[model samples]
Target: MVSTALQPVTLSEFMQLHNIEESPAWELLNGQVLQKPMPTFYHSLLQKYLVRAIDNANSVYEAFPELRCILSQNSVVPDITIIHHSRIPLGNQPIQGAPDWIIEILSIDQSVTKLISKIQACLAEGTQLGWLIDIQEEVIMVFVPNQPLLLARADMALTVLDEIALQLTPNQVFGWLKR
Candidate 1:
Protein backbone atom coordinates (compact mmCIF):
# COMPACT_ATOMS: atom_id res chain seq x y z
CA MET A 1 0.00 0.00 0.00
CA VAL A 2 1.13 3.52 -0.72
CA SER A 3 2.06 5.46 2.39
CA THR A 4 1.30 9.13 2.47
CA ALA A 5 3.05 9.73 5.77
CA LEU A 6 6.39 8.64 4.44
CA GLN A 7 8.96 11.30 3.68
CA PRO A 8 12.05 10.29 1.74
CA VAL A 9 14.74 9.51 4.31
CA THR A 10 17.99 7.61 4.35
CA LEU A 11 18.43 4.40 6.34
CA SER A 12 20.27 6.25 9.08
CA GLU A 13 17.53 8.84 9.26
CA PHE A 14 14.89 6.12 9.45
CA MET A 15 16.83 4.36 12.17
CA GLN A 16 17.22 7.57 14.05
CA LEU A 17 13.46 7.93 14.18
CA HIS A 18 12.28 4.37 14.76
CA ASN A 19 13.45 1.56 16.98
CA ILE A 20 13.19 -1.85 15.39
CA GLU A 21 11.86 -3.63 18.49
CA GLU A 22 9.20 -0.98 19.08
CA SER A 23 8.17 -0.19 15.51
CA PRO A 24 7.07 -3.58 14.33
CA ALA A 25 4.44 -2.15 12.00
CA TRP A 26 6.87 -0.24 9.74
CA GLU A 27 9.61 -0.99 7.23
CA LEU A 28 11.93 1.10 5.11
CA LEU A 29 12.30 0.38 1.40
CA ASN A 30 14.67 2.43 -0.72
CA GLY A 31 14.65 4.98 2.11
CA GLN A 32 10.87 5.37 2.41
CA VAL A 33 8.57 4.34 5.20
CA LEU A 34 6.13 1.53 4.38
CA GLN A 35 3.42 0.36 6.69
CA LYS A 36 2.85 -3.36 7.07
CA PRO A 37 -0.35 -5.18 7.90
CA MET A 38 -0.64 -6.71 11.33
CA PRO A 39 0.23 -10.40 11.15
CA THR A 40 -2.40 -13.08 11.62
CA PHE A 41 -2.21 -15.95 14.07
CA TYR A 42 -1.28 -18.32 11.30
CA HIS A 43 1.56 -16.06 10.28
CA SER A 44 2.81 -15.88 13.85
CA LEU A 45 2.57 -19.63 14.25
CA LEU A 46 4.44 -20.36 11.07
CA GLN A 47 7.20 -17.94 11.98
CA LYS A 48 7.56 -19.41 15.45
CA TYR A 49 7.70 -23.01 14.27
CA LEU A 50 10.08 -22.27 11.44
CA VAL A 51 12.45 -20.45 13.76
CA ARG A 52 12.44 -23.41 16.15
CA ALA A 53 12.97 -25.86 13.33
CA ILE A 54 15.88 -23.90 11.93
CA ASP A 55 17.45 -23.49 15.32
CA ASN A 56 17.19 -27.23 15.91
CA ALA A 57 19.28 -27.78 12.80
CA ASN A 58 22.19 -26.51 14.93
CA SER A 59 24.04 -24.92 12.10
CA VAL A 60 26.22 -21.85 12.41
CA TYR A 61 23.15 -19.72 11.87
CA GLU A 62 20.54 -18.32 14.24
CA ALA A 63 17.01 -17.21 13.46
CA PHE A 64 15.48 -13.94 14.59
CA PRO A 65 11.84 -13.06 13.98
CA GLU A 66 10.72 -9.65 12.77
CA LEU A 67 14.29 -8.46 12.54
CA ARG A 68 15.15 -5.21 10.79
CA CYS A 69 18.08 -5.62 8.40
CA ILE A 70 19.79 -2.48 7.22
CA LEU A 71 21.06 -2.60 3.66
CA SER A 72 23.06 0.24 2.11
CA GLN A 73 20.12 2.56 1.62
CA ASN A 74 17.14 0.28 2.28
CA SER A 75 15.91 -1.50 5.35
CA VAL A 76 13.56 -4.48 5.59
CA VAL A 77 11.88 -6.51 8.25
CA PRO A 78 11.85 -10.10 7.18
CA ASP A 79 9.46 -12.43 8.98
CA ILE A 80 12.37 -14.65 9.91
CA THR A 81 16.03 -13.82 9.39
CA ILE A 82 18.78 -16.39 9.74
CA ILE A 83 22.19 -14.83 10.07
CA HIS A 84 25.56 -16.47 10.07
CA HIS A 85 27.29 -16.50 13.45
CA SER A 86 30.12 -14.32 12.26
CA ARG A 87 27.74 -11.57 11.28
CA ILE A 88 25.78 -11.55 14.52
CA PRO A 89 26.13 -8.20 16.22
CA LEU A 90 27.88 -7.84 19.54
CA GLY A 91 25.18 -5.63 21.03
CA ASN A 92 21.44 -5.04 20.63
CA GLN A 93 21.79 -2.99 17.48
CA PRO A 94 19.87 -3.91 14.33
CA ILE A 95 21.51 -6.16 11.74
CA GLN A 96 23.91 -4.15 9.60
CA GLY A 97 23.61 -5.95 6.28
CA ALA A 98 21.60 -8.52 4.35
CA PRO A 99 20.82 -11.66 6.24
CA ASP A 100 22.11 -15.02 5.07
CA TRP A 101 18.53 -16.21 4.73
CA ILE A 102 15.30 -14.20 4.66
CA ILE A 103 11.72 -15.46 4.81
CA GLU A 104 8.59 -13.41 4.27
CA ILE A 105 5.18 -14.69 5.29
CA LEU A 106 2.37 -13.45 3.14
CA SER A 107 -0.52 -11.52 4.65
CA ILE A 108 -3.89 -10.75 3.09
CA ASP A 109 -3.23 -7.02 2.79
CA GLN A 110 0.36 -7.28 1.58
CA SER A 111 1.34 -6.86 -2.06
CA VAL A 112 3.11 -9.81 -3.66
CA THR A 113 4.98 -7.55 -6.03
CA LYS A 114 6.36 -5.47 -3.19
CA LEU A 115 7.38 -8.60 -1.34
CA ILE A 116 9.14 -10.04 -4.37
CA SER A 117 10.90 -6.76 -4.94
CA LYS A 118 12.22 -6.85 -1.39
CA ILE A 119 13.43 -10.42 -1.87
CA GLN A 120 15.09 -9.58 -5.15
CA ALA A 121 16.82 -6.61 -3.56
CA CYS A 122 18.21 -8.80 -0.81
CA LEU A 123 19.36 -11.47 -3.26
CA ALA A 124 21.08 -8.86 -5.38
CA GLU A 125 22.79 -7.54 -2.26
CA GLY A 126 24.47 -10.88 -1.49
CA THR A 127 21.81 -12.72 0.49
CA GLN A 128 22.30 -16.45 0.07
CA LEU A 129 18.63 -17.43 0.23
CA GLY A 130 15.15 -15.92 0.25
CA TRP A 131 11.69 -17.44 0.52
CA LEU A 132 8.25 -15.99 -0.03
CA ILE A 133 5.86 -18.23 1.84
CA ASP A 134 2.22 -18.08 0.83
CA ILE A 135 0.27 -20.09 3.36
CA GLN A 136 -2.98 -19.22 1.60
CA GLU A 137 -1.74 -20.88 -1.59
CA GLU A 138 0.16 -23.60 0.26
CA VAL A 139 3.18 -22.78 -1.83
CA ILE A 140 6.54 -21.00 -1.64
CA MET A 141 8.64 -19.08 -4.13
CA VAL A 142 12.37 -19.49 -3.76
CA PHE A 143 14.91 -16.87 -4.87
CA VAL A 144 18.62 -17.35 -5.30
CA PRO A 145 21.37 -15.38 -6.92
CA ASN A 146 21.83 -16.12 -10.63
CA GLN A 147 19.36 -19.00 -10.56
CA PRO A 148 15.84 -19.50 -11.88
CA LEU A 149 13.14 -18.93 -9.25
CA LEU A 150 11.91 -22.24 -7.85
CA LEU A 151 8.25 -22.81 -7.17
CA ALA A 152 7.58 -25.47 -4.55
CA ARG A 153 4.53 -27.17 -3.13
CA ALA A 154 3.98 -28.70 0.27
CA ASP A 155 5.39 -32.12 -0.50
CA MET A 156 8.53 -30.96 -2.20
CA ALA A 157 11.71 -30.37 -0.22
CA LEU A 158 13.22 -26.93 -0.81
CA THR A 159 16.68 -25.87 0.09
CA VAL A 160 16.42 -23.45 2.99
CA LEU A 161 20.09 -22.64 3.50
CA ASP A 162 22.52 -24.71 1.50
CA GLU A 163 25.52 -23.22 3.25
CA ILE A 164 24.31 -24.76 6.49
CA ALA A 165 23.06 -28.01 4.94
CA LEU A 166 19.45 -27.15 5.69
CA GLN A 167 16.54 -28.25 3.56
CA LEU A 168 12.86 -28.22 4.52
CA THR A 169 9.78 -29.31 2.69
CA PRO A 170 6.74 -27.06 2.71
CA ASN A 171 4.74 -29.84 4.29
CA GLN A 172 7.23 -30.11 7.11
CA VAL A 173 6.98 -26.39 7.68
CA PHE A 174 3.21 -25.99 7.26
CA GLY A 175 2.63 -29.09 9.32
CA TRP A 176 3.23 -26.97 12.39
CA LEU A 177 -0.18 -25.47 11.78
CA LYS A 178 -1.62 -28.51 13.52
CA ARG A 179 -0.42 -27.11 16.82
Candidate 2:
Protein backbone atom coordinates (compact mmCIF):
# COMPACT_ATOMS: atom_id res chain seq x y z
CA MET A 1 0.00 0.00 0.00
CA VAL A 2 2.96 2.36 -0.49
CA SER A 3 2.20 5.18 -2.94
CA THR A 4 4.88 6.38 -5.33
CA ALA A 5 5.78 10.09 -5.48
CA LEU A 6 5.88 10.16 -9.27
CA GLN A 7 3.23 12.18 -11.04
CA PRO A 8 -0.07 10.55 -11.78
CA VAL A 9 -0.18 8.28 -14.81
CA THR A 10 -3.03 7.04 -16.96
CA LEU A 11 -3.96 3.36 -16.97
CA SER A 12 -2.24 2.78 -20.31
CA GLU A 13 0.94 4.52 -19.20
CA PHE A 14 0.95 2.63 -15.92
CA MET A 15 0.58 -0.67 -17.75
CA GLN A 16 3.40 0.29 -20.10
CA LEU A 17 5.76 0.97 -17.20
CA HIS A 18 4.81 -2.01 -15.02
CA ASN A 19 4.40 -5.59 -16.15
CA ILE A 20 1.75 -7.78 -14.60
CA GLU A 21 4.33 -10.52 -14.08
CA GLU A 22 6.30 -8.33 -11.70
CA SER A 23 6.54 -9.58 -8.15
CA PRO A 24 4.91 -7.48 -5.44
CA ALA A 25 2.32 -6.13 -7.88
CA TRP A 26 1.71 -2.44 -8.40
CA GLU A 27 -1.79 -0.93 -8.64
CA LEU A 28 -3.14 2.26 -10.12
CA LEU A 29 -5.86 3.80 -7.99
CA ASN A 30 -6.99 7.37 -8.37
CA GLY A 31 -4.19 7.89 -10.87
CA GLN A 32 -1.52 7.14 -8.19
CA VAL A 33 0.69 4.07 -8.24
CA LEU A 34 0.69 1.94 -5.10
CA GLN A 35 2.54 -1.25 -4.30
CA LYS A 36 0.65 -4.12 -2.77
CA PRO A 37 1.82 -5.40 0.58
CA MET A 38 3.68 -8.68 0.56
CA PRO A 39 1.55 -11.63 1.55
CA THR A 40 1.92 -13.23 4.95
CA PHE A 41 1.78 -16.97 5.63
CA TYR A 42 -1.89 -16.91 6.57
CA HIS A 43 -2.70 -14.59 3.73
CA SER A 44 -1.09 -16.90 1.24
CA LEU A 45 -2.82 -19.97 2.67
CA LEU A 46 -6.24 -18.38 2.62
CA GLN A 47 -5.78 -17.25 -0.94
CA LYS A 48 -4.75 -20.72 -2.05
CA TYR A 49 -7.57 -22.49 -0.28
CA LEU A 50 -10.20 -19.96 -1.25
CA VAL A 51 -9.32 -20.14 -4.90
CA ARG A 52 -9.41 -23.90 -4.74
CA ALA A 53 -12.75 -23.89 -2.99
CA ILE A 54 -14.24 -21.53 -5.51
CA ASP A 55 -12.95 -23.35 -8.53
CA ASN A 56 -14.06 -26.69 -7.17
CA ALA A 57 -17.52 -25.49 -6.35
CA ASN A 58 -18.60 -24.91 -9.94
CA SER A 59 -17.29 -25.02 -13.45
CA VAL A 60 -19.24 -21.95 -14.53
CA TYR A 61 -16.75 -19.70 -12.74
CA GLU A 62 -13.03 -19.86 -12.13
CA ALA A 63 -10.89 -18.15 -9.52
CA PHE A 64 -7.42 -16.79 -10.15
CA PRO A 65 -4.76 -15.55 -7.74
CA GLU A 66 -3.25 -12.08 -8.06
CA LEU A 67 -4.80 -11.49 -11.46
CA ARG A 68 -4.56 -7.90 -12.61
CA CYS A 69 -7.90 -6.48 -13.76
CA ILE A 70 -8.62 -3.20 -15.44
CA LEU A 71 -11.76 -1.57 -14.10
CA SER A 72 -12.57 1.72 -15.74
CA GLN A 73 -9.79 4.17 -14.83
CA ASN A 74 -8.14 2.03 -12.15
CA SER A 75 -6.19 -1.19 -12.43
CA VAL A 76 -5.99 -3.58 -9.45
CA VAL A 77 -4.66 -7.04 -8.75
CA PRO A 78 -7.15 -8.63 -6.44
CA ASP A 79 -5.97 -11.46 -4.19
CA ILE A 80 -8.50 -13.69 -5.97
CA THR A 81 -10.52 -12.77 -9.01
CA ILE A 82 -13.51 -14.93 -9.93
CA ILE A 83 -15.11 -14.65 -13.35
CA HIS A 84 -17.55 -16.66 -15.37
CA HIS A 85 -15.86 -19.06 -17.77
CA SER A 86 -17.64 -17.49 -20.68
CA ARG A 87 -16.43 -14.00 -19.77
CA ILE A 88 -12.75 -14.90 -19.52
CA PRO A 89 -10.87 -12.90 -22.09
CA LEU A 90 -8.61 -14.64 -24.57
CA GLY A 91 -4.91 -14.00 -25.15
CA ASN A 92 -2.16 -13.08 -22.65
CA GLN A 93 -3.45 -9.63 -21.83
CA PRO A 94 -4.68 -8.60 -18.39
CA ILE A 95 -8.43 -8.87 -17.70
CA GLN A 96 -10.15 -5.98 -19.39
CA GLY A 97 -12.98 -5.52 -16.87
CA ALA A 98 -13.81 -6.00 -13.24
CA PRO A 99 -14.18 -9.57 -12.16
CA ASP A 100 -17.46 -11.07 -11.06
CA TRP A 101 -16.12 -11.49 -7.54
CA ILE A 102 -13.11 -9.69 -6.02
CA ILE A 103 -11.40 -11.00 -2.89
CA GLU A 104 -8.76 -9.12 -0.93
CA ILE A 105 -7.00 -10.69 2.02
CA LEU A 106 -5.75 -8.18 4.55
CA SER A 107 -2.01 -8.25 4.97
CA ILE A 108 -0.17 -7.22 8.10
CA ASP A 109 0.01 -3.41 8.38
CA GLN A 110 -2.06 -3.01 5.22
CA SER A 111 -4.62 -0.22 5.17
CA VAL A 112 -8.12 -1.65 5.47
CA THR A 113 -9.57 1.61 4.26
CA LYS A 114 -7.64 1.51 1.02
CA LEU A 115 -8.62 -2.08 0.47
CA ILE A 116 -12.27 -1.28 0.99
CA SER A 117 -11.97 1.60 -1.46
CA LYS A 118 -10.52 -0.77 -4.03
CA ILE A 119 -13.32 -3.25 -3.51
CA GLN A 120 -15.90 -0.51 -3.78
CA ALA A 121 -14.36 0.61 -7.01
CA CYS A 122 -14.80 -2.85 -8.46
CA LEU A 123 -18.34 -3.04 -7.21
CA ALA A 124 -19.09 0.27 -8.87
CA GLU A 125 -17.87 -1.19 -12.12
CA GLY A 126 -20.34 -4.16 -11.98
CA THR A 127 -18.52 -6.59 -9.74
CA GLN A 128 -21.21 -8.68 -8.06
CA LEU A 129 -19.39 -9.49 -4.83
CA GLY A 130 -16.39 -8.35 -2.78
CA TRP A 131 -14.74 -9.92 0.26
CA LEU A 132 -12.24 -8.44 2.66
CA ILE A 133 -10.74 -11.20 4.79
CA ASP A 134 -9.23 -10.01 8.07
CA ILE A 135 -7.17 -12.88 9.41
CA GLN A 136 -6.29 -11.21 12.69
CA GLU A 137 -9.94 -10.58 13.43
CA GLU A 138 -11.05 -13.98 12.13
CA VAL A 139 -13.89 -12.32 10.29
CA ILE A 140 -14.84 -11.44 6.74
CA MET A 141 -16.43 -8.23 5.62
CA VAL A 142 -18.68 -8.82 2.64
CA PHE A 143 -19.68 -6.15 0.16
CA VAL A 144 -22.41 -6.31 -2.47
CA PRO A 145 -23.88 -3.68 -4.67
CA ASN A 146 -26.75 -1.77 -2.94
CA GLN A 147 -26.54 -4.01 0.09
CA PRO A 148 -25.40 -3.24 3.62
CA LEU A 149 -21.98 -4.54 4.52
CA LEU A 150 -22.18 -7.99 6.09
CA LEU A 151 -19.85 -9.30 8.76
CA ALA A 152 -19.40 -13.08 8.68
CA ARG A 153 -17.60 -15.05 11.37
CA ALA A 154 -17.31 -18.48 12.86
CA ASP A 155 -19.90 -20.74 11.18
CA MET A 156 -21.73 -17.95 9.45
CA ALA A 157 -22.17 -18.80 5.80
CA LEU A 158 -20.73 -16.26 3.39
CA THR A 159 -22.71 -15.04 0.43
CA VAL A 160 -21.52 -15.87 -3.06
CA LEU A 161 -22.66 -15.14 -6.55
CA ASP A 162 -26.06 -16.63 -7.34
CA GLU A 163 -24.76 -18.95 -10.03
CA ILE A 164 -22.06 -20.47 -7.84
CA ALA A 165 -22.92 -23.32 -5.48
CA LEU A 166 -20.17 -22.76 -2.95
CA GLN A 167 -20.97 -22.52 0.75
CA LEU A 168 -18.24 -21.12 2.98
CA THR A 169 -17.75 -19.75 6.46
CA PRO A 170 -14.97 -17.80 8.11
CA ASN A 171 -14.07 -20.76 10.24
CA GLN A 172 -13.76 -23.04 7.21
CA VAL A 173 -11.53 -20.48 5.47
CA PHE A 174 -9.28 -19.93 8.50
CA GLY A 175 -9.23 -23.63 9.23
CA TRP A 176 -7.20 -24.18 6.08
CA LEU A 177 -4.24 -22.57 7.79
CA LYS A 178 -4.40 -25.02 10.71
CA ARG A 179 -3.54 -27.96 8.48
Candidate 3:
Protein backbone atom coordinates (compact mmCIF):
# COMPACT_ATOMS: atom_id res chain seq x y z
CA MET A 1 0.00 0.00 0.00
CA VAL A 2 1.14 3.55 -0.71
CA SER A 3 0.63 6.56 1.49
CA THR A 4 0.00 10.08 0.22
CA ALA A 5 -0.83 13.38 1.78
CA LEU A 6 -4.01 15.28 1.07
CA GLN A 7 -4.01 18.17 -1.34
CA PRO A 8 -3.75 21.75 -0.16
CA VAL A 9 -6.62 24.25 -0.36
CA THR A 10 -7.20 27.60 -2.03
CA LEU A 11 -7.63 30.79 -0.09
CA SER A 12 -11.32 31.05 -0.79
CA GLU A 13 -11.90 27.44 0.15
CA PHE A 14 -9.93 27.85 3.32
CA MET A 15 -11.87 30.95 4.26
CA GLN A 16 -15.20 29.36 3.41
CA LEU A 17 -14.42 26.21 5.37
CA HIS A 18 -12.73 27.83 8.32
CA ASN A 19 -14.30 30.54 10.43
CA ILE A 20 -11.37 32.93 10.25
CA GLU A 21 -13.24 35.56 12.21
CA GLU A 22 -13.59 33.14 15.10
CA SER A 23 -10.24 31.44 14.58
CA PRO A 24 -7.47 33.73 13.39
CA ALA A 25 -4.64 31.25 13.73
CA TRP A 26 -4.87 30.09 10.13
CA GLU A 27 -3.45 31.74 7.03
CA LEU A 28 -3.59 30.82 3.35
CA LEU A 29 -0.49 30.88 1.21
CA ASN A 30 -0.33 29.86 -2.42
CA GLY A 31 -3.30 27.56 -2.20
CA GLN A 32 -2.09 26.06 1.03
CA VAL A 33 -3.32 26.42 4.55
CA LEU A 34 -0.72 27.44 7.10
CA GLN A 35 -1.42 27.20 10.81
CA LYS A 36 0.62 29.61 12.83
CA PRO A 37 1.77 28.70 16.29
CA MET A 38 0.45 30.57 19.27
CA PRO A 39 2.40 33.73 19.86
CA THR A 40 4.55 33.81 22.98
CA PHE A 41 4.87 36.58 25.52
CA TYR A 42 8.15 37.68 23.99
CA HIS A 43 6.59 37.75 20.58
CA SER A 44 3.67 39.83 21.82
CA LEU A 45 6.03 42.16 23.59
CA LEU A 46 8.03 42.73 20.45
CA GLN A 47 4.89 43.23 18.42
CA LYS A 48 3.47 45.75 20.88
CA TYR A 49 6.67 47.76 21.00
CA LEU A 50 7.15 47.75 17.26
CA VAL A 51 3.58 48.81 16.67
CA ARG A 52 3.91 51.73 19.05
CA ALA A 53 7.23 52.79 17.53
CA ILE A 54 5.81 52.78 14.04
CA ASP A 55 2.56 54.42 15.11
CA ASN A 56 4.32 57.26 16.89
CA ALA A 57 6.88 57.79 14.16
CA ASN A 58 6.91 60.95 12.09
CA SER A 59 5.38 59.41 8.99
CA VAL A 60 2.17 58.90 7.09
CA TYR A 61 2.14 55.12 7.31
CA GLU A 62 -0.15 53.27 9.70
CA ALA A 63 0.97 50.09 11.37
CA PHE A 64 -1.28 47.14 11.90
CA PRO A 65 -0.56 43.74 13.40
CA GLU A 66 -1.86 40.40 12.18
CA LEU A 67 -3.72 41.85 9.23
CA ARG A 68 -4.71 39.55 6.41
CA CYS A 69 -3.28 40.68 3.10
CA ILE A 70 -4.87 39.32 -0.03
CA LEU A 71 -2.43 38.98 -2.87
CA SER A 72 -2.93 37.82 -6.44
CA GLN A 73 -3.08 34.12 -5.57
CA ASN A 74 -2.19 34.00 -1.91
CA SER A 75 -3.34 35.32 1.44
CA VAL A 76 -0.94 36.12 4.25
CA VAL A 77 -1.13 37.35 7.83
CA PRO A 78 1.92 39.34 8.59
CA ASP A 79 2.99 40.01 12.17
CA ILE A 80 3.23 43.68 11.34
CA THR A 81 2.07 45.41 8.17
CA ILE A 82 2.43 49.07 7.26
CA ILE A 83 0.64 50.97 4.54
CA HIS A 84 0.74 54.58 3.47
CA HIS A 85 -2.21 56.80 4.39
CA SER A 86 -2.98 57.46 0.74
CA ARG A 87 -3.38 53.75 0.04
CA ILE A 88 -5.60 52.87 2.97
CA PRO A 89 -8.42 50.51 2.14
CA LEU A 90 -11.68 52.29 1.36
CA GLY A 91 -13.96 50.66 3.93
CA ASN A 92 -13.94 47.87 6.50
CA GLN A 93 -12.19 45.31 4.33
CA PRO A 94 -9.00 43.36 4.18
CA ILE A 95 -6.11 44.75 2.17
CA GLN A 96 -6.50 43.68 -1.43
CA GLY A 97 -2.86 44.10 -2.49
CA ALA A 98 0.70 43.83 -1.26
CA PRO A 99 1.54 45.93 1.74
CA ASP A 100 4.22 48.58 1.62
CA TRP A 101 6.14 47.00 4.51
CA ILE A 102 5.93 43.60 6.18
CA ILE A 103 7.57 42.38 9.38
CA GLU A 104 7.52 38.80 10.60
CA ILE A 105 8.96 37.95 13.97
CA LEU A 106 10.27 34.42 14.17
CA SER A 107 8.18 32.31 16.50
CA ILE A 108 9.45 29.42 18.55
CA ASP A 109 10.06 26.30 16.45
CA GLN A 110 8.73 28.09 13.38
CA SER A 111 10.07 27.52 9.86
CA VAL A 112 12.12 30.50 8.80
CA THR A 113 12.16 29.27 5.21
CA LYS A 114 8.38 29.60 4.94
CA LEU A 115 8.58 33.13 6.31
CA ILE A 116 11.32 34.06 3.83
CA SER A 117 9.35 32.65 0.93
CA LYS A 118 6.33 34.77 1.89
CA ILE A 119 8.50 37.88 2.10
CA GLN A 120 10.13 37.18 -1.26
CA ALA A 121 6.76 36.67 -2.88
CA CYS A 122 5.48 39.94 -1.46
CA LEU A 123 8.57 41.78 -2.65
CA ALA A 124 8.18 40.35 -6.13
CA GLU A 125 4.57 41.43 -6.12
CA GLY A 126 5.34 45.10 -5.23
CA THR A 127 6.00 45.30 -1.52
CA GLN A 128 8.69 47.90 -0.88
CA LEU A 129 10.26 46.36 2.23
CA GLY A 130 10.33 43.06 4.13
CA TRP A 131 11.85 42.11 7.44
CA LEU A 132 12.44 38.69 8.96
CA ILE A 133 13.11 39.19 12.64
CA ASP A 134 14.59 36.36 14.67
CA ILE A 135 14.24 37.14 18.32
CA GLN A 136 16.30 34.14 19.34
CA GLU A 137 19.17 35.30 17.17
CA GLU A 138 18.50 38.95 17.93
CA VAL A 139 19.04 39.76 14.28
CA ILE A 140 16.92 41.12 11.46
CA MET A 141 17.13 40.23 7.77
CA VAL A 142 16.22 43.18 5.60
CA PHE A 143 14.93 42.76 2.03
CA VAL A 144 14.44 45.50 -0.53
CA PRO A 145 13.83 45.38 -4.24
CA ASN A 146 16.89 45.78 -6.49
CA GLN A 147 19.16 45.98 -3.49
CA PRO A 148 21.44 43.62 -1.63
CA LEU A 149 20.05 41.91 1.48
CA LEU A 150 21.15 43.46 4.75
CA LEU A 151 21.73 41.51 7.97
CA ALA A 152 21.30 43.98 10.79
CA ARG A 153 21.95 43.46 14.48
CA ALA A 154 22.87 45.35 17.61
CA ASP A 155 22.92 49.06 16.81
CA MET A 156 22.40 48.80 13.06
CA ALA A 157 19.25 50.65 12.11
CA LEU A 158 16.71 49.24 9.67
CA THR A 159 14.68 51.34 7.26
CA VAL A 160 11.13 50.11 7.70
CA LEU A 161 9.02 52.12 5.24
CA ASP A 162 10.18 54.51 2.55
CA GLU A 163 7.10 56.64 2.99
CA ILE A 164 7.63 56.70 6.75
CA ALA A 165 10.52 58.07 8.78
CA LEU A 166 10.54 55.03 11.06
CA GLN A 167 14.01 53.54 11.51
CA LEU A 168 14.41 50.85 14.17
CA THR A 169 17.56 49.10 15.24
CA PRO A 170 17.88 45.42 16.06
CA ASN A 171 18.85 46.23 19.63
CA GLN A 172 15.84 48.44 20.07
CA VAL A 173 13.53 45.79 18.70
CA PHE A 174 14.94 43.02 20.85
CA GLY A 175 15.21 45.16 23.93
CA TRP A 176 11.48 44.87 24.47
CA LEU A 177 11.95 41.23 25.38
CA LYS A 178 13.88 42.12 28.48
CA ARG A 179 11.95 42.30 31.72
* Sort order, TM-score high to low: 2, 1, 3
> Which has the greatest lDDT?
2
Candidate 1 TM-score, true structure as reference: 0.91
Write model 2 residue lDDT over 22-86, tens digit each, in one string: 68899998788888988988888899899989999966999999998998899999999999898
lDDT of 3 by residue, 26-125 (tens): 6676566776667888888888988898899968988898888888877788899888888788888888888899999998777888888889888988
| CA RMSD of all predictions | 1.8, 1.3, 3.6
Q: Stretches of candidate 1 above 4 Å error? A: 5-7, 18-23
Model 2 residue 104 lDDT?
96
User: By the TM-score metric, which is better: model 1 or model 3?
Assistant: 1
Q: What clash count does candidate 2 reach?
A: 0
Q: What is the lDDT of residue 144 in candidate 3?
A: 97
- The global Cα lDDT (0 to 1) of model 3 is 0.81
Tens digit of per-residue lDDT, candidate 1, span 1-179 = 44534468777777776444454557778666787677899999999888988898899899999887888888888999999999988998779889899999999888999899888888878899999999888898988889999988968888777656667888877888776
lDDT score at residue 79, model 1, on the 0-100 scale: 91
Alpha-carbon runs more than 4 Å astray in model 3? 1-5
